[model samples]
Target: MLARIFINRPVLACVFSIVILLLGGISAGLLPVAEYPEVTPPIVRVTAYYPGANALVLADTVAAPIEQQVNGVEKMLYMTSQSNNDGSYTLDVTFAIGTNTNMAQVLVQNRVAIAEPSLPDVVRAIGVTTKKRAADILLAISLDSDVNPATGKPYYDALYMSNFATIQLKDAVSRLEGVGDVFIMGQQDYSMRVWLDPDKLASRNLTVTEVIKVLREQNVQVAAGQVGQPPASRGQDFQYTLSTLGRLIEPKQFDDIVLNTDKNGEITYLKDVSRNTLGAKSEDIMSRLDRRASSGVAVYLLPGANALDTADGIKAKMRELEPRFPPGLKYAIVYDTTPFVRESVHEVQKTLLDAIILVTIVILVFLQDWRSLLLPVIGVLVSLVGTFAVMKVMGFTLNNLTLFGLVLAIGIVVDDAIVVLENIERWMEKGLAAREATMKAMEEITGPIVAITLVLSSVLLPSTALGGLVGQFFRQFAVTISVSMLISAVNAMTMTPALAVLFFRNRKPGKHAEDKEALPWWGFGLLGGLATVWLLTPILGPSLGLTTGEGHGESAPGGLGASLAGLGATLVLAFPGAVGGGVLGWFMVRPVNWTLGFFFRGFNWVFDWATRVYGQIVGWCLRFSAVVLFVYVGLIVLTGFGFSRIPTGFIPMQDKGYLVTNIQLPDSASLERTLEVTDAVEKIALETPGVAHTLCLPG
Candidate 1:
């Protein structure tokens, strides 16, 4: 048929370069070396509290019945609530983009358990907040110490490395494996400060709620209930006994316990009045660069892990626990996203090795021979070693947008081996011999090189049905430029016509009658289609930087002049951005469809019964082409209920960097006058010239 594959061109280029180096070593050992891709977003939060109510009575008793039962869950989008007369209440929410924060946390814990028997049991806890990126923070810590460097330490400490990188390394990187949470600001957690004496509690008539019930029932521990095993005579399995004794470690054990007694067995203690002090609790803390005090650890990277191998195994376990710290405590990890995904996968492997050494020096200065530059550099390394062995058997990873779509398909993967080696050097200058010029150049370009590599691999096959997160980042850059241009059009049809019938025979067709009167067939197909219309006329005519005297002059176009200047700039900029955004959106679509047609004419009789159920889905799309392809796959499975009615986000919060600053003061402000209003807001963030550095954390 195709003239028996060049009658053994070096055993078909050594069995298609050993089956493309065994599928490019199994797609470079199965792809997935990610840093980011599998996204969920659609956030959630909730929270609650209330004890001494206030933020307008805890936002009308616990954030309005938990935001009216999570405002009808699915893709809610905006919720935001917050109250704080120091008796908090939250809300947050934010769904939409394929919302499913684990089924929106079981529909917000069954709509906060149907408004928990109408809340108000002095509401205490609610919490939800997940929207996983393993709950954000893919690594941040940054510590370096030597403290008392004669007590200087001033080197702009990013909020003491963001609160000792989240409370001394986020509870051991939130116990590692795909860590979900580890947020820490600058520093916090160490409290105890009771300074009572109001005239010795008015000569011991004691009150402040009886010194907060003798310091929370002498630092609580209670258990008692359960001491059964003794009545076990017949039916076995009995060991029911639970006992516990209390012990409040220190602060003079709340001035020696015993509270109400006096009926005769008198003993009302607590140093009879009060004074407990032990300090260091809540008020943002994050310290590192030797100023000791630490807390800042943002490790998150779990959903289908691998963010640079979980941030290089958490910086090699923080340099193997930096000698179990203590010598002026230390830790260091400035920031990571694995060095911006290894500098964008080493800048697309230096732009795919400078576009394969500038397309092998412009095909050896325009095929000046050497077997037309070793049969198109062994047919572009056997079509990128069989497109990295089908991206290591479809595991796929060499990221940075699938290695920038395999270095922008290295000149459209050598345009059908430069059009079947310029049509077997025009049939070896017309006298054809080397196996009849490779069987008349594969029967005159085998059906336009298999219909231009199946219409350029069917233009990224609708980006693998792109569902969410921009179809998991352009479905691995459209399956690495559609399987490396379908393995460079099957190595330009069987290893460049079996290495051009064994290394381009005669190979002396360079100046045949001054290159056949300087190229004839419509003057070399109108100078190879006007160098693919001046290499795709700067995306369809404009930048006339046209200097094609060929070779490396005003460089750009290559093989088949970059596939007809990228298919005439993708049909001249996608047919004028889809017919000019559909005719400037039809003259502002009749006053925006009469302002959303008066809220969609109140669902126009349920959209006229969904247009008579899509007119029985266009009469079953022609009396059933498999029931119009199962009603076009039930309208693509009702596009997952129109993508769960759209509105979800976990990251993408851009109210510019961040600054919460609340300052108030009065509640017994001490800690050195609340660190002098946190050193005058860190001197107005070092005199803000577009600030970029600030640290005054205490809340």
Candidate 2:
């Protein structure tokens, strides 16, 4: 009935399909592209630093209090903490998939606040930070220097480069849209150092503690009062504020600070006991690029952000800032994940194209008519492209899983169209007009198409109910295929029947235009046998005492006469076998034809041959119904057994176009020793096959 309405009003059917195409085209542009759907659980990290504290001390003082309070927060799956020997502590709180990272961060921050009072004063003063961040690194930008134009030497040292990235690049990148955070790896901040002389301190009767007390007291802000008072002076025209030296900024100012005065008109200054200079806060870490001093700035992506878009924005921002960089300073995005994502998406797109072409070719071969082929090809395009609209509505991405689903759906989506088209052609061959044939065909297939669509959707839709990362990975894939199938069924019921009516012509009994049924089954078997023998003769001829008379050379018969004789002898031996085998194979296949003709009396020969073979197999099973059912049950049991025995994982390991290597040294190893080990490792890695570059960061 639905097909009849569309068959009468073909314009309405065409309009319906065109609307789907337009919406799908627009949705394809809007949907985010990714290598995979979001499968990583949301994470909130807590970081704190305690200067001069060992790993053991940090574990006892900083980690314990925080973990105790932060554990078992809302939606939390698990939490892990690491206390490093360098007095740094990190706690990662992993929440269940689909949890809002912002809410998870707030909950963790609240817990951390409750533990703050129990922490040591020094650790508390240094401060603890809580923020939501992804565990995966999106990009790693490196800064290095070339020859300086002014001095003909490297423009900046390690400390200057590290601090420059911290001051200039880190905040700029962090403020970019879709960026979660930025970190300056192996960073060193400037601080004034006072190298105290114990001998000078003994001579002055001052201890290290006394000198530290004086420094703290003197190196502070002085809030001096106003110079003019408005309340007392009636004639005062202006109020002047006083300015005084605040915190010391230079080593020279620290050197001149007073420490103590002796008994007889003498004074002690800080310079009397200690030497001071501006230096890095700590020299415990070092970073390098290609054995040159460098600084690394790692950019993190926010949860649910588009990775390709975020990476593009970062690169664009860097290019905009390149001109303002100091002479000889340059930045490179040494490590990026976007290229892999882009290439993978492109590869899937190619596969999808290949699938469409292949499905078209197969339909053309089977239908044997270009006019008939167009219907299924159009159905495939409409079903696949229209699925994108549903994907956008459901918040699905154009990722590997969904694309793979589309590639598989190509074969499936073409089935409904082909079924309707074949049935309509059958009715036309029975002398019915095109419109009447379309109505009759739709009456037969409409129920079967709906049933197939429902069956397929029911099978795939349940995967969406699976829990955790597995569900996230497969949900889009399942839904994409299911939507395509539903669209295909709709097209079969509407556009397919309408197009058939418009494209096909009426045929009278015994006057069909196409001659697809002229060849008999026996003729096909004979030709097939002859072709098989022709192919195998070259290789099996010599083994079967049949040759081309080559080895005899001059002594043997030569020229066309000899070749004809040899060919005649070979045919004489092969003809009888070919004919006998062909006749025997035809007899064996006759039952299949009989079974097919019984069910589909008026269909074309090719369709009948295919359907009859399948029907004969089913007939055989029906004859041995008990044995067939037993075998089927046994196969189901075997499948269950095999599935349970196979090794399983959330996702297979992939070569992501780069590798990460982490090196650790002995607990008591100094930074210099760590650098030595890293240098050796870097050299070995460079010598190994397939390694393009190496970055070493020792801390």
Candidate 3:
């Protein structure tokens, strides 16, 4: 019924296809691209700092109380905590892979709130930091300085860079779209370091602790009360608040801080015991870029934020912020995940396009007419464009998995077009008019087309129900393929028949086509199978590396061999693989057409024998159905056993032109010790073959 409506008006089909094409084109640009589906388990971190405590003390005093409260966070899978001898503690609560992190975070935050009262006063004053961790770092930016030609020293030291990054860069970057948090790494905030001399303290008859106490007391910040009365009647006199700039700002201010008032009417100020100098806080982190001392910031993306957008936004922000930076310092992207994502996506797209062109060329080869290629071309184009539109609506991103799904969709979409158009072309070659041929083709193919759609959907749809990370990842793939196949089925019935009816009405029979009947079902089964495999070569082709002229004899300079190799490639290169393949039977036939025919003849002969043998086996199986069932069960068990021996992972690793390596030294290692190991590892990586560079992450 639906096919008849579309067959009557081919114009409507064309309009529908154009609309979908437009929608897909627009959505492709707007869709957020990422490296992987959101498969990482959600993590919420709870942290506290208790000054002057060791790791054991910190764990017992801070980490333990917090973990005890946050242990039962809803949807949480497990919790892990770390305590550092520097008096810092971090409790990390990890939820299930697919849990809604926002809700999980809220639940954990509530629990942590209850435990905050039990924390030490120092820890409480420092504030317990609780947050849901953002997705992986989108970009890492390093702020480095160049040596001044005017001065022997570099423009600014590490302390200046650290303060500038914290105050300037972090805020600018965090304001960008999709950015969750911009963490300033390897930065001990600017501070005044009071270097007290034990010798000076003893001579002054004061303890080192007494000196520290005097300095701390002198740096107190307080809000003083107003000196004037309230303005109950209109202000009779000007009012002012009694306040003092209590906290010391400059190094000179500490000189007046009294360390003690001795027996005599005399005071010993801070300068008597120690010299105060401007510096940064105690160093707990070390960051380096290519062996240069530096500081950096790591930008992260919020959940569901477009990674491509966030990465690009970060770079754009850095560019805008770079100019205002201090003399000789500039921001450079030290690490980025987006480039790999963009390149992989581009490769997959190029492959998909190649496959489509190759399929079209194969259609042209078998049918020997461009008009016969029309319906199949429209089917593929419509299905692909429409799939993107659906993806946007489904909130699916363009990642490796969805791209994989789209790549697989090529075969399904083409298969349907092949059935519809091939049948119509065969009937048309038999001298029937276009309408009569389409009618007859539809009559024979309609039921099978519908059934094929159902079978394909059944095969693919179950994957969407997968319960784990792999299931979430490939759901896009499974849904895409399932949806695309169903779409292809619809197009085959409606648009394909419409196009055949419209185009075939004016067609003239080919001279060779009149002399013989087209290949029968089994003949097409043999030939069509070969054509499909041949068409898949461009997409399935191995990636090759470029060679320099150093090895072996002089290069076999490009000539006819390269040209002919590229001839089929020209189509795929232009329209990409699948599109260019339609140009010729010669393209597929290559140096020897007859050899292909010879191979085809051999295949037919082999298939004939296999079929006869299979028919006999089927008859025997029918007679002994119980034994056949038992044999099938035995094979299933054997297959499971064989598969069990093979190693498995959620998805195979792909070389996306990037590598992420993580190393942890002993838990008790200090920041300096960590950098020692990191530099050693970085040196080894740089010395290794094919390794271009390495970035040691901030400690």
Candidate 4:
């Protein structure tokens, strides 16, 4: 048996656990942290612009043709399109939840290519591009400005602020590790606009189209061949290259372009008809922060990159750029999804750690010796660490799914080690030597231990075998539990036995070990009451999820309100559980104990009678064997149909703490009006006992 193999090489077992722990720790750092496993359907968006077209025109001319071509693309679940009065078209194509997004995008692109010729000329000129859209943002950094400390200048205009961000900040943030793209919001590029006076143009006998054509023609640059030393062999005289600066780089150059000359000797220049100035391209978006013109970089994370690492990398890059920023320009974190991701992951991690603590206490309570808790605790730690290496190998993240699975697996993993240790202790209590007890215990219990591990594996591994996105969500949880179990099984056969023998050897038995007496009536009552309290305390915190899907009657408020509410709830619950538990203990002293004891004996009597009755029923069925067989087969068939007709849910949908608080104002509420409402809310919140802060984010 494998137990024999491991028992022979106890040092190897110790080394194995140590090595796995080291590797798993390293893998934990490497694994990505995300909010959820990718469960949402991947979406590809196609955008087009038609400068002067209305929404109806854009829908009919720009959106219709593209949607027709992209509709039947591979794995596409559905397509939706929208047209705006500003002459923009957005066609969103959602693919199957687990579709290969890159390939799907390419397919949509090729189809959009086929529709290109059908679109209007202006739409084609403006160009249509596809972008992969994730449901949630990764991070967003605000480009805010401060009053110059030295110069006393106000914040710059939105146009200049956006250009500086696009030119200096966008590329820097984009190059950070794990960042997919950093798109500048409210961005406007440098451009030139020529103010056309229709009266002057009419006086000049020129039209807007003619001016455009003349400018386009005059803006051209021509290249002449270079001349050096008369072709190096033919000409005798040294020659310098002839050159001309043909491109227009100034407003004077543009105005000086000759459009036409009057036959009556009155010459007209382009400057007489129009005025040109350097300015920003037209912009439709306005970003603001602290009542100043603001800009931001919307950072997208790579598909499976570590979010915390990505966020930290971006903030680090931002810090490096901050010192070099232009005077009056500063940066702020407007929004970052990473903090929530970090909190949730850490919360689940804390839950697991708390679980370990809880299990340790319970183990100590049961064993009554700290030394006996070591093997089980060691087994749990080793199994958990070892599972991380497996997670890294399998490309699983340390998200809610995997972490919750580990939380559930704690009991199973510690159970294996606890069982093996308890068996060794039992064998020693039979008056056998430590080594003999270890060997004898393993011989008797190893098969059953292995069987139980296999049985647990059988239950978990099937969830991994399920198909589609739901299956993918469960895959990490199931695989994690399965790997932890396998590790625990190995530890049970090796580490537990080895540690038991090593520690128990040469150890003297205590008085309780030699002669243990049953607990008296009062002692049993006290123990039972304490167990009830122990069970009730932990349940109180998480039981918030079970109260009609809301916490504390109303949805829990954000910030300190939630904390205060939870504390109040614990106090409220614990008071009753404590008082009633004590009362229960007192009542169970004698009369209650007799009643419980009698009831349990009656339960045992019912079970014994059932066993005897089953035998008699079996004999009667044997007399009508054919009829009984038919009836049993019919019941099995009925159960099969019953199971088939049962309704299924993917999983229990917990609140996940994504509560949105809506603040409403009058229908025609201006920005100031909305801020008034916000201020009023904050004022009330400030007056409240536990609330300390409030945040308002406008959509």
- lDDT against the true structure, per candidate, is 0.61, 0.82, 0.74, 0.74
TM-score pick, better of 3 and 4? 3
How many steric overlaps are in each model, in order? 46, 0, 15, 0
Candidate 2 residue lDDT tens string, 1-699: 898889989999999999998789778766766889888898998999987678899999999999999988999999988997678899999999889998998999999999999999878887999978777899898999997777877888888988899888988898987898788888877778899999999998999999988987898888788866657567777777898898998998998999999889699999989999988777777778866789998898888776776777787788888898997899877788877787788799999999898887677556655568778988999999899999989878889999999999998999999999989888877878878888888999999999999999999999999987788889999999999999999999999888887777534433465433322445445555556557766777666545533331111222235445555656755575667666765666556545544433444666778898999999999999999999999999999999999999866787777878888777778878888888888888889898766777888
Listed in order, each prediction's TM-score against the native is: 0.35, 0.76, 0.74, 0.68
Of models 2 and 3, which has the larger lDDT? 2
In model 1, what lDDT does residue 377 have?
A: 69
Q: Candidate 1, residues 1-699: lDDT per residue as tens digits? A: 543553554575567667786657545543445634545555556566665567887777667777787786766767677786556566657666545456766677678777766778647333434334444566566555454566687342344444444555666677766555555544444446667778877765777787777667667778766645655577666676686657565677767766666667877776676677665443433343222334455566654455654565566567677676556556555444555555556667798888987997676545544455666767676676677667655555666677777777878878778888888877877877666777778888878888987887788878878776777667767877877778777667776777677765544544452221111122233334445554565554544333232221122332234435554555554454445445545455445445544544455667689899999988767776786787778999899888998888744553334354667789856666766676777676668776544433454
**Which order, best to worst by lDDT?**
2, 4, 3, 1
User: Each prediction's Cα RMSD?
Assistant: 27.4, 16.7, 9.8, 12.4
Please give the lDDT score at residue 388 for candidate 3.
Answer: 80
Q: How would you encode candidate 3's per-residue C-alpha lDDT over 307-343 as one tens digit per residue?
A: 7667766766677777788768876677777777766
The TM-score obtained by model 2 is 0.76
Candidate 1, residue 656: Cα displacement in angstroms equals 31
Worst 10 residues of 1 by lDDT: 514-523
lDDT of 3 at 411: 80
Q: How far is candidate 1 from the true structure (C-alpha RMSD, Å)?
A: 27.4
Name the better of 1 and 3 by TM-score.
3
- lDDT for each residue of candidate 4 in 1-699, tens digit (9 for 90 to 100): 666666667887788789988888778766777766777777788888887578898888888888888878888888888897657688878888667777877899999999999999868977998877565568777777777666776567767888888888888877777765666775666666688899999977789889878877877778766677444776556666667768787787777788888898887788888888777665544555544567877887755667776777677678788899887788787666766666777799899989998998777556644457778989999999999999998878889989999999999899888888888778777778777778888998888888998998998899877777878788888899999999998889887887777777776543233222112334444445445545665665456522322221221222234445655665655565556656665666556545545554576678789999999999999999999999999999999999999987876565432333578766655666666665676566657675423334332
Q: How accurate is candidate 4 locally (lDDT)?
A: 0.74
